[model samples]
Target: MATLPVEYLRTTRLFREKIGDVEIISFEVPVHKYFSRNEIPYLATALDVDFRKMENLITDMKYGRVAVEKLWAYRMDADIIRENKKVLLPDLASNPVDGEVDEFEDAKVLKIHVGPLKEYVRVFVRPRQGFREVVVYRKPPHPAFVRYVAYL
Candidate 1:
């Protein structure tokens, strides 16, 4: 099986503010686009929100708004876009489905559903391989929901 170029992995951060008192931070690392392989990590250190509270809140909020002061800070500094565009764009553009599925013996296409959203993400991976084709189709929640979810 052929290996997907390393440039496929990508990350993004989401932030929110509350009544000038507290701020919330969340980060997402897309494993295969629709289905986030990992939960968003807490980026704010001073927030009083607890883990349980935040977990419950994630279901309600997807991408709140506190102003995306920086969308891809680390990537920008690394010039990842320009460096990997040649290999990345074609792979992302080729697959349009959404969701995850089991690996097969031949080149197989699968879709993975993400969260509570009624959307599907498509992925194409090499048969019986660990890592190959992966991409994310982000459909963030409403602005207000994002703000509330950030607290989670």
Candidate 2:
């Protein structure tokens, strides 16, 4: 398979270190856009969080007041939008649909852990005929979420 480039809105230098005549710079880079064989994209944000906070994140997602049609995450892949699972993001209830739109109320959230340190929150939506199963991983809000919250 061919490699794919990750998407980023921007980048910034974090810090610089110098030793004698050599200097090194550090940058806080965005995570790669991981893709399935079918080209579905997902990005996982690393959070050095405790179990309690992870639980809280899930609880908040289960019962959070989300805005309508807001762009919570940066990458809104075409495959995800086409699946009509875009509602799984903090943005929902406003995306145009053939009929009634799917909201968080119409989905199920599953909390899963891969190892002692890796945990994932996945949301599954109602299945539609002739379409792939809709599964969206609930990640931490993108940096833009706070930066543009007022405008959104």
Candidate 3:
């Protein structure tokens, strides 16, 4: 929807736990750049998420709507990702911790049940084409994806 390229959309704002809006610690990099097993370390450091967990999430997190504070259909171009970040970054920074994880196994959508959020921040990464949307959200990953949260 916007004209600016998704340069800042280094990571989709799919997470709210570690870094809300990926809380964007300035380590955000291109989505494609984070796929390789070797690249996992850099991606983990940059995003501030656990490297081992991220690797697992990346491998298993495909074709699902990761709802954190909201639901997002992964994959976007430069323009949309840019716009969403610009609008949502501020609110994400201020999001309170009063949230709940809503699990729906049948539908395959895991959501963070935070009530009454002001504004919205959603990143759009361009699909490489011929690939299903995988691990749409980076942080605050699905409960099942993380044994830590699943057991709790």
Q: In TM-score terms, which candidate is top?
A: 3
lDDT of 1 by residue, 1-152 (tens): 97643322233443332213322232343313221212322112112345444333443333432211112212222344465211111112123324445556764444443332233333343322332332223222211111111211
Candidate 2: where are CA atoms >4 Å away?
A: 1-109, 114-119, 141-152
Q: Which candidate number would show the highest lDDT if scored against the true structure?
A: 3
The stretch of ten residues in a row with the least summed lDDT in candidate 2 is: 143-152
Local accuracy of candidate 2 as per-residue lDDT tens digits, 1-152: 96653322233334443324433332332222211111111111112234344333333332342211112333334343454222222211122112122245544333433222123234344333432233445343221111011101
Pairs of colliding residues, candidate 2: none
Q: Each model's C-alpha lDDT?
A: 0.28, 0.27, 0.29
- What is the TM-score of each predicted model, taking all chains together? 0.23, 0.22, 0.25
2 or 3, greater by TM-score: 3
lDDT of 1: 0.28
Preferred candidate (lDDT higher): 1 or 3? 3
Clash statistics: count for each candidate: 16, 0, 7
What's the C-alpha lDDT at position 54 in model 3? 59
Cα-based lDDT at residue 152, candidate 1: 19
Model 1 vs. true fold: TM: 0.23
